[model samples]
Target: MTTKRIIPCLDMTEGKVVKGIQFVSFRDAGDPVQLAKQYSDNEADELVFLDITATVKNRPILLNVVAKTAKEVNIPFSVGGGIRSVSDMQLILRAGADKVSVNTGAVTNPALITECANAFGSQCVVLSLDAKKVAPNRWNAFINGGTLDSGLSAVDWAKEAVRRGAGEILLTSIDMDGTKKGFNLELTRTVSRAVSVPVIASGGAGSMQDFADVFQTGEADAALAASLFHFGDLSIPELKRYLSEQNISIRRDV
Candidate 1:
């Protein structure tokens, strides 16, 4: 069986890691390089650094931060936000990002997915979707840092992106972001069932049980959390040990 991954997310802005609720009211988390190295040492399966405001601000990703993080961390990480073309992905990859995540750019021009995948191979392309519940059992994908709705069904979009060559899906629930309630199981399961690619579930992770639920009930291939780890609420080693106790396969060598 493929071991489920536990990834720590670094939502960044102005070169500092930040976290917010429902994509607003941001608060400083810590230094990206410091957190990246800490998570790496803690045995996080992987890391994700997203420039939260890059798309809405129409700015490029913070390559200096990415490079600094690359130099400090041993595990692979993905970078996203403000990536509009193949060149953007190239620059991010060249800066030491193991994968490039595209959201707003893909929503605006889905061909960008095919282009990035072709340029760097599908494994290097991750489709990051910010989804909000529009109705019971239905969620809409949002773009522009979750300010605008893309009007695409989250599940359908995931399937389409995978068909276009996305190797993985980073599904974040905008409604549940920073709520610390739990993951959006319905949204995650739907997307995970629709796509063959690994689906990384984000938003609303409050406890270790939440992680187990996301993997077993939500059918997610991975679970990602930001504030839970950033604020000393939980450690990767503790979470991994808990997951192992639950018979959820995870890398536990930290």
Candidate 2:
């Protein structure tokens, strides 16, 4: 089996890293650059910086912050929010994001995904779907940071995104986000199994067993959480060690 990845997420707003529950009730976490460096120093597998309010604010990503944060970490970094066009992706890539994630933009004009993948290669395009359960065993994609429902099936969109050249899928469960109850295993497994590309499961990570359950049962390629890691609930090394003890393959070396 491939090593299960543990990714630390930084949800950005107004140039600072923030964490919110269910995509609301925002709280300050820390400076994005400092947090990025700390995670890198601790051997985090990867880091994701999301401009959570970018879409709602209708502004471009904070390139200055992205550039500064990229310099602090050597690991792969992905940036999202306010990314609407190929030029936007170019700027972000030039600024140092290893990958660019899009949701509303890609959904509005899926051609953006093809254009980005064509311009920067599929490995650079990550389609982030903010999904929420609407009916029995059914979930719809949300855009603009869980504010608007796209009415698209999470599973169907994931498949189409992959077909359109998205190399990865960042699946965030809006209902489960920041709940720490556990990952939406049903939602995660459905999307993961539907897409050929790796799916990073986000939201509802409460404990190490939660991580294990997502990896083993949810079939997620990578599991991402914020508050648990940002609040000192668990360190990356500590989590990795626990996962290793559970016989889950994981990267030990930074």
Candidate 3:
């Protein structure tokens, strides 16, 4: 059985790691490089560094910050935000990102996904979807740090992203983010069922049971969280042990 992955996400803005509720009310977490090293040493399966402000500011991802963070950890890391073109993807991968995640950029120019996949292989291309519930039965896409609405349905956009050559989907529920309630299982299951590629569920991870629920109920390939890992409320090793005890397949440090 393939072990389900546990990933820690670092939301970076102006070079500092931060976290917030529903993608707002930001609070400083710590230095990106330092926090990343700690997570890596503590047995985090992977790390995601997001330049949260770059896209909102209409700027390129800060490579200097990525370089600094990458230097501190040995685990595979992914970088996203303000990544607009193939050249931008190249720069990030060269900076030590094993994968490059694109959200707003892919929405604006979907061909960018195909371009990066062709140049760097689909495995290196990740499509990060920021989605929010707009009505009882509808969820719309948001971009530029959840400040602008794309007016696209989550299901439709996810299918389009996969068709355009995304190897994986990093689906985050803007409604559930930082709520610590649990993952948006319906949304995750919807996307995972819609796409052939692996779907990673992010946002709203409050406890160990939430992780297990996401994998079992959401059918997510991986579960990613920020605050739960950031504040030491849940350590990766302990979380994995808990998952194993529950008989949920998970990668354990040998």
The TM-scores, one per candidate, come to 0.92, 0.93, 0.91
lDDT of each: 0.88, 0.88, 0.87
Please give the range of 10 consecutive residues that has the lowest summed lDDT in model 1. Answer: 20-29
TM-score winner, 1 or 3:
1
Residues 185-243 of candidate 3: C-alpha lDDT, one tens digit per residue: 99999899989999999999999999999999999999999988777788899999999
Residue 195 C-alpha lDDT in model 2: 83
State the weakest 10-residue window (summed lDDT) of model 3.
20-29
lDDT, candidate 1, 1-254, per-residue tens: 88999999988887777773222222323677877877898889999988877743434448888888889988889999888999989988998899999999998999999999988999999999999999888889999888998899988898899999999999999998878899989889999998999999999999999999999999999999988887778888999999999999999773
Q: Over 4 Å off in model 1, which ranges?
A: 20-29, 55-61
lDDT for residue 245 in candidate 2, whole number 0-100: 97
Please give the TM-score that candidate 1 achieves against the real structure: 0.92
Give the alpha carbon lDDT tens digit for every residue of 101-214 in model 2.
999999999999999999999999999999999899899999877899999988899999999999999999999997889999999999998889999999999999999999
